[model samples]
Target: MKIRKNTLLIMMILLTVTFMFANTKNVSAKVTFNKTSKSITKGKNYTIKISGVKSKNIKKVKLKYNKKIIKVKKLRKNKYRITGKKKGKTTLKATVKYLLFDYTPAVKTIKCKINVKNKAAKKKKTNNKKNNDSEENIKPEIDWGENNIDKLIAQIEQSKTYKGTLYKLNDYTVFNKGEDGGEDQYGLITSPFYSTIDWYSKKDYDKIMNEVKRIVKESKITDDMIDEEKAYRIGRYMVKHIDYDYSVYGQRIYETLFDKKTVCAGYSVTYALICRYIGIDCDFVHTSGFYIDGQNMNHAWNYIKLGDYYYVVDLTDAYCGQKYDITGPFFRESGYVDSKQMSYIDEKYKTSDYTKDHKVDNISHYMRCKKNGDMSQTLTDSELYNLPE
Candidate 1:
């Protein structure tokens, strides 16, 4: 088993060359951190992501950071989660490996600078601003048609298209005597808010719709939000800012937007407008009468189509001018519909809901997910968006 010194030296040289070649094979890819620096409160986590490569494209990742200042966890091959252990700064360094364009294994280094803030300091500033906002929003001075709200609405409406006939002057059963001297029914459609129809439209048919949509389009809607999130956020915003004033244009959404005040009808129509703009399937829900607090009165709300079923949402009842509690939104308020009773079909105004007094009046053009019991449960994002094709 003895080998010559010259032979051993030659084998050593070959091994050294092979090691150098292997080290030289891997090249750096042009990778950069998604955000060079991110700021969050203490004990909060920030996403560690890199640009120019997706999580799926990554093959492997190795992270190095100070454990005393932060804790890093790998969410995916390329994506990592960094939690701030203390209120300070930490540099999270990652060596990511991915397949290059030619399918060669490439490595790149990226760093994310994390700055964590003290929760106490953050909460102080938030509270100060909130107190000031409460004072201003408590009695907001809104123009109750100073510059002509209808005109402003008409401008926006002129550029938009609508579904169904935008008819005006909704008339109900008004018995008129015919030439035969008998009573003749002349009213067209029986609606949930036939009594409040006078208060519904602002002026004419088109202009009335103009104000409702104008506010929604002009409101603060972001692209990153899902349909459910958008709907709930907008509804919550109105509840927080809008004052309930039934004095002028209370039923129309114009007053809700401009005057910063409106009734139940305004809330419904405004939300419906929001849903329409966001590409969410929504309905004009009306309730002839539903018993509430020992009174049987009419109400108006919306029924939006999410996934396979439509859920009733009464935004007015959700908050009632109080703080916005998301648990009472949409499906949470309507309760849950079992599979056996999934008869959302039938052209009923079921979208408006609250139809104990008049069961047949809550007819929606589409199917309505029948609500039973008082279920305080809400649906998750997966259930809302993932629909059966």
Candidate 2:
């Protein structure tokens, strides 16, 4: 009986030792992040794969960056694939929780150094050359007719007579109120006119010409600086000073310029006029199917052609007020408007290549092509023939 008892005690001790050893083995699972070269371009997509993990009871594997979840994908038993977009350094890790033992946890992690290349770095150089070539190639299409200042002034005055008449939608009448009951009125009231005139009156034209020359001489503004940066700066400045008031519905140019009050349309038109007066090539763009908080509406904005590319400038968005709950000014407030937030003037704007985060809906215009051959109302052959030769 004594020997049997001793044998039983020895068996129990061996079993306990074997169990402890098994518990310390950790299931022999390993994890690795493939493609750790750590170099990628900004605004591009990339993928990473995690392999070498061996565990049947593993639940989930999470890949994180700076403690933020980057991606999580399951592949059968112990494999995973993670994909991420954006540029920045990120932390990577994998965790496996056993199903049977609630307390058993398996964790492994590594530090990944990621480098983001600039998206525009290569395109910018090529774009610069293309811009210079296009600028040189562009020539004025309209004939000024013998530099006849008197004739120009007379024509401008005649056009001005139709000002203040509401613009009718769908018709390009320069003076009379537009069709659709002037609902499409875009410009503000100025002296005798409600709509924008391509040519100014004698007095205003002379003053504007003098101011242009003065500005050129003083170097306050230059043709070279009339690019995206200049437009952005002007947009920011205008939005800062102008107060958005929806009550001034269908208000003409005079009200915005003198009263410093206007809506998105007024703000855009006013800015475009100012830019034109300063010798910048700009135009008003009409976008269809616009929405404020998801309600569909028609909207207008400005598109400025700088060099070769046309950039969109929406003054309303540039100067939009902060959310009521948020306090203080936006950090990094320079021309850093998020393109995704804008509703473009054109509906069929190029969007496939861009990521969802960079996408903006309801685009009314692209500056490069606004009122160009494709979108603008052109004088038909018959209409041109009707004009007196």
Which candidate has the highest lDDT of all? 1
Worst 10 residues of 1 by lDDT: 168-177
Error of 2 at 69 (Å): 62
Best by TM-score: 1
Report the lDDT tens digits of candidate 1 across residue range 1-389.
Answer: 35688889989999988875565453343477778888876676666557676556788777787788888765445455676788888887878888765566677788888887776542332334445542212321112241222233223322111222122221221112223453322221223443222232223323534554454545434332345555665666667667655565556545566677777777776676556545565555555434559764556666665544455666776666345443432443244322222333223543455344333323221223335331112234343332211
Model 1 bad stretches (over 4 Å): 1-219, 245-249, 289-296, 321-333, 336-347, 350-389
TM-score, candidate number 2: 0.31
Estimate the lDDT of model 2: 0.44
Model 2 weakest lDDT span, ten residues long: 323-332
lDDT of each: 0.52, 0.44
